[model samples]
Target: MNTSPSPSGAHHVEEGASVRLGALVPLTRPGWVEAGRHLLAGLDLAVTEVNDAGGIGGRPLELVVRDTAADPERAAAAVDDLAGLGVAAVVGEYHSVVARSAAARADALGVPYLCSSAVLDALTEQPTEWVARLAPAQSHGWRIYADFLLGAGRHRIAVVTQPSVYWASGTRILRDHLAARGGTVVELDANELTPEALCDALVDHGATALLLLVGQPEPAVPIVRAVRSDRRLAELLVGAPAGQPEFAEWAAVLGADGAGIPFLRYLPEHLGPLGERVGKELRARLGEAPSFVAFEGWDAVTVLADVLRSHGTDRAAIAGAWPDVAVEGTRGTIRFSRTPGIGVRQWAWPPVQVVDRDPTDADRFRILRTG
Candidate 1:
């Protein structure tokens, strides 16, 4: 058995005896560790349940975990290593840029990759059957968010953005969607401007809503604080389409100030029987309510396990099985199809919601709109 240590830690699993799935998550700094934790919780819970029920055809389902740390180069290297290690397929990745790199590398290496959380529409530059994604495309989800902004009567939108492919794509989506609806989009460089200066720009530009397309804690938190403290922008709506507010860390850091900032989430309004059961189990595993990312992680494994059962661990066989997949996930019936503009096979759309923390109770999420 190959018991080599990974960058994060050592994952012990039977080399040839077990069916292995490579898990790529951001478990370290610069990576959204909270989301990674929830994702891992769901993945672990599903793997445990799968094994308990009688692993893939009596052979144990093993997950070899790797921490991407939100780095694209690091993620690409992990994919290479996982492929070398003979993982049946590679799974999981929260950052779109990182997932894009991993996807390109996996495709080149002929390894099947199921992206869990990255929403970038163009996961791969060219159409390839090797990569598939569970999250709604950035265009799909951001357009819904644009509609939500329009419905709320916020016409003048401002985006606080950084220099990243993911953020740039999101800004472009929002701009095109909103501009077609008689709305305007203004982009403010998060790296160039201080939090206070961003608030000033919001006022100067007469923006009614501001979307944060930047990373957490460093500038996102500071920008929110500056905006909240500035009375001039009292009527302004603070939004995060990237779903930074979905995690407990957002509430822990921003408290009541973080509430009312609508963000995108991929979850149904109400849980079904399986969803309810999974939610309970995930909560117990996570020691708190699970984010939609956790559901994505669980659904990823659930679909993969079903695929492995029907089609063995052959890489090409698994990649070819994407179209035939029809597993009941925690959110809904999961399936993959060729979505136009998205190179990789995609779960057409997961349930998208514009949610925010209830002002009275920061712990409770209030669904403002669904699409």
Candidate 2:
């Protein structure tokens, strides 16, 4: 294996005679580094497995790793750096903002990018033949949440949304989906009100369920605490679609207060055979259970390897072969769909589940529903 550092501070790891692939992740970002580490672990495992299996056309696959630091400009620059490195395809990113910028850059360079975990609805909106996602769009996941709420007979829903494009699009979809099911929605901005005031408003509106669309954990944690503390709102169903990614940390912060709060997740420990194997491998490696982001990283590499094996390492060939590519991934059978309004070249059936925060054990949240 040959390893070198580039001017952009990205590391290139080449093993044997190989087809180089690019991995863009936030390895050193303050808030995102741990997630990036787990993501890299899963990607590395997939690459190792592929190489052990004779790789694509007898050439081992190499990974050129880049740290985006969750910054948009840095992420875009990493794509350019990867293009200069002559990588066959690019995978692995967590933040949606960074993925959006990187997607544009990858498209311009004509390199196939299989997005691992970024869920912004607009990432696939731009006309790009070079980019596809392994994760579902945010709207797709929110729809699952909506179905969960409606099925549970929680009709009077209050939405607490952050001022982000990703949250806005998801909120819009949630609102429409709820309304279609004959449910009422009252929207509130998380940034505009204090947590206390937000709790008061939900109670005043008689909202049976609070749908939090905040994309980050900082605000969602406070809101959850405030809602849980209030006697009047104690019975309200608190749901945060974005909080799934940070559930372990924030749930620990909330302790017993976080119990019964529902959130959407792509993978849980109780998933079937494939999920069990992946989770066990990750646990043995990381000394803890893996997050969905890790599963996404593994699947991203898995899909990319499948594409390269059949289509060769040509960028245009990989791009052309993406639509027909189907692989049984860690989450489910991965397939791309160009459904209008959802985004083009996006995963069609991203499996999502609603899991409640366990009061006693942070790692043992029970799955309520799967969709």
Candidate 3:
């Protein structure tokens, strides 16, 4: 048995008569490469464990990976290609728009897709039995975030946003939820303003909290720096609901400025035995503390492997097994069902929390709130 890199830069293992699961991740630029790396680490670790435990009933379980690169069209095409390759199922995608495209394609092609991390409420325009998701919908998680803000007395919220379907949806969720609760949400367009100008807008709007809804490292890092340095905004709270500050990259770049900026994460207050063991392996594989996204990857495979054992590798059978998934996962007992307004089978939710890096120790996360 040998593992090698494909010409398209995808990683895969091939042995005779293997059971293949196509993996979609953003391994390149314009995508959240750090998140993708952690996600793939968890997926790979689970596959290794599954193989060690008798190779999915003696047929090797292999991951045929394709880089989505955060492109919806590219993800759709990759789904088609993976289907043609006769994969048992397709799994993993960190970007919601890309996952949406992939879900639609997988539905059309009659393939099973277990979405790992994207959390848009509407994964497909129409309901289909082919797709199931592990992430909490935007409405569920963001409302919890809004509540955290409100509880903290940050009633005036501002979101610095870019033009993207995912960001727009998140902003809408925050806006509607906050509005109903007597909180006001102000929107700042990241396209038209420099980091300094954004700071000025934050001051002008009198927003008690500023949430970064834009991409990272470019405008986000600079914006955080500007906000931290500005004397006028010294009392303002900085937030990133999209989980930008979850990775080590945030602290590596911003140092002390990255701390105390709360973000959303899906994790229980305490890991059970399964979670503890997986967390250790994932940490070794990733060379850092694994994020919740990594756990999602591990759980996706754990559920899929259980399905394959009970339902066999048939696409229709695997898709049919969504409602029957009751496997023990790192987070909790994994299951799926029709959530109101969400188009695909959803996990109801993973544990949702508002957490921030400790100001005194950037490496430690303090749980601010849970929902």
Candidate 4:
């Protein structure tokens, strides 16, 4: 966990120079900004813990963070800056499209990056040299969602997605997983065309349940209303893990039917075991309660800290050393891609209902159905 230079290598590594790491997280957006702050807090706490424990090989760990604003374009620029700073590695890219851009930048600069978020299915193909994952991939969500539907003997699913690449890429995985379960999909492109277009979609897509792959919060209103307005569309809901915050405004504006799929790794109030520990540490550091993004941040930092602790802080060393490390994440079971340079796993693909209000606990979210 230390970044200090040993006696033999002390001459090469300047003494007391902080080993800088970078994070390209979406920090300007509404809920995600809160998420980014939490992640930053966790990273800060992790770095503190590392230094208090004697630092990474005796070198102080310094983190350089950039706000990608939940935009892929901004994320690309942020990664460029991180690479310019000669950071050993970076952690966390929330949106897959943003990660794609960062991955490209990481490739050109030869910097190691961990895609802790942005589980889009196609992110694995992004060209990067030193990258690791603290979570599973976007396809995992599809696979899990598919498993749920299949276990229920539900076939013929309706698909709704943003034209944005995140959902676009993930929907394919959903399709493949559903197909594996003998489910046929009737697809509709809800590519931010218009409210009318979105409203018409529910009437058009013929299936028992609907899968929305959009990452934005605004569209939920029209979609939810469309589904509720149409009595023909039963089991109207989303398959992605959009929590209550993102879905809240839409619900308040258009009112929700209390139906849909919400695939989340950890809930805020009931964030499992790791969440309990991480949450406490995060609160201590940030001086406030952690939000969703904090978990993502902790996942990235702890993974990087572990790799640095075991493998050494050098880029190649971190990359070469991370293959077999499996750490218990906030959500649970975070393992790196044994392929090292390959990528992160898409995780937390479990499905819950997209409810109007936060249920007392996770159980009600899973138990109730409105579509």
Worst 10-residue lDDT window for candidate 2 reads: 1-10
* Residue lDDT tens for model 4, 1-371: 11232221121224467777887767687325555666677777777777888777788888887888877777778877776676778887666677777876665555667776565555646433355555445555456556766665567677666677766666677678777667887767666445456546555655666666554455655665566666565555445443433323333444435433454443433468768887888777777656545677777777777777787656656655555667766765565543332343333332222232343332234432311
Model 3 bad stretches (over 4 Å): 1-16
Position 155, candidate 4: lDDT? 77
Give candidate 4's error at residue 255 in angstroms: 6.9
Task: For residues 347-368, write the lDDT of model 3, one tens digit per residue.
Answer: 9878999999999999999999
Each candidate: RMSD to true structure? Answer: 4.8, 5.2, 5.4, 5.8
Q: Which model is ahead, 2 or 4, in terms of TM-score? A: 2
The window of 10 residues in a row where model 4 has the poorest summed lDDT is 2-11
User: Where is model 1 more than 4 Å wrong at Cα?
Assistant: 1-16
Q: Candidate 3 — number of clashing residue pairs?
A: 0
Q: Ranking under lDDT, best-scoring first?
A: 1, 3, 2, 4
For candidate 3, the lDDT comes to 0.90
- For residues 207-260, what per-residue lDDT tens digits would candidate 1 score against the true structure? 999999999877899999999999999999999999999999999999989999
Q: lDDT per prediction? A: 0.91, 0.79, 0.90, 0.60
**Candidate 1 clash pair list:** none
